[model samples]
Target: MQRQLIQPYLLVLGIALTLSSCFNEPNYPDTPSADFKGIFKYTIAAGTGVGAAKRDSVVLTIGFKDGDGNLGNDIPVPKADSARYAQNGGWGNYQIRTFRLINKQYVELVQDVNKVLFFPDLTKGKPKGAIEGTIDFRQIFTYGSSFKMYPTKFQIKIRDRSLNESNVVETDTISVPFPN
Candidate 1:
């Protein structure tokens, strides 16, 4: 009789464990912070351009938050018009760094071209408080590019109007396709 009861209990426990393992959820901060967390979803758009110059684009969606509502820049007109100018463009408070999985390890994607991401003006006449929103990052690549057919992820961080830097968040692994 005791053995029979133990078997039922074990079965129930096993089923519970299995169900929990299948659960997939976004990793976000329980409390507000300079930094936030979330799930990274990626999609690709192909057939952009013609012939050998065909290009592919990768789009990333980042769900994030900020304790203080200062996540972007308010630069006016030409970046050169203002003293706030980022290397290649008018990228504001956010920085994006990409990496790929190589031999079971993460390696940064390095190239001569600049690959930075900028956050738009998020605090335009908005009250300062807990802020939460989604940011999309997109990039276009030519056929046969080094990053065309690789498993990649991104490390992203942001800055507040007060110049407070948020903690960096890394995205999940996603695959982009190359020309056949």
Candidate 2:
């Protein structure tokens, strides 16, 4: 009887140890800092419409450093000047609030109808229901190009949610270099 109890305890302890060790971070990234060079500019573009007409540019630039904790000037991202969303559900019920990058893989462009504060919902107040309009996701990645230049590409995705009227616009990407 004691042997049976011991086996179960050992098994549990083994699992706990394994789980803890799984959290150990690995020092490997698909797009390592070494893979890039010189000034890298990440920009948030306004695809179309009044948002495009009223484009508020935000850019980030990385100086001459191979990831040794060095960030340089902020350069504007390439402007698409071709992205526009037509009003589908309401009458001029859209307001571009914020443009943010979520994690290392998501760039979100928000358009809230009700002008809801995304902080309370996205950060602290995660609503379970829906949100208004749609969010576009953009990713910037290097195509393993030349040594002097790592040409980047931007990928875009349109995602729509349901809610009364919340203005939260974000355009994010995972391919962009993360700030240390």
Best by lDDT: 1
Query: How does candidate 1 score on lDDT?
Result: 0.60
Candidate 1 lDDT over residue span 55-165, tens digit each: 556665666676666566655434552334343243346667777777889898763343434556676887756667777766555656443477877777665555455
lDDT of 1 at 150: 70
lDDT of 2 at 102: 44
TM-score of each: 0.57, 0.21
Best by TM-score: 1
Instruction: Please list the residue runs of candidate 1 whose C-alpha ends up more than 4 Å from where it truly belongs after superposition.
Output: 1-52, 75-92, 111-116, 145-148, 177-180
Tell me the tens digit of each residue's lDDT in model 2 across 104-171. Answer: 43344433432321111121233232222212222232222221221123222211222133222222
Backbone clash numbers for all candidates listed: 0, 28
Query: Model 1, residue 29: displacement in angstroms?
Result: 12
> For candidate 1, which ten residues in a row score worst on lDDT?
28-37
Candidate 2 wrongly placed segments (more than 4 Å): 25-119, 125-180
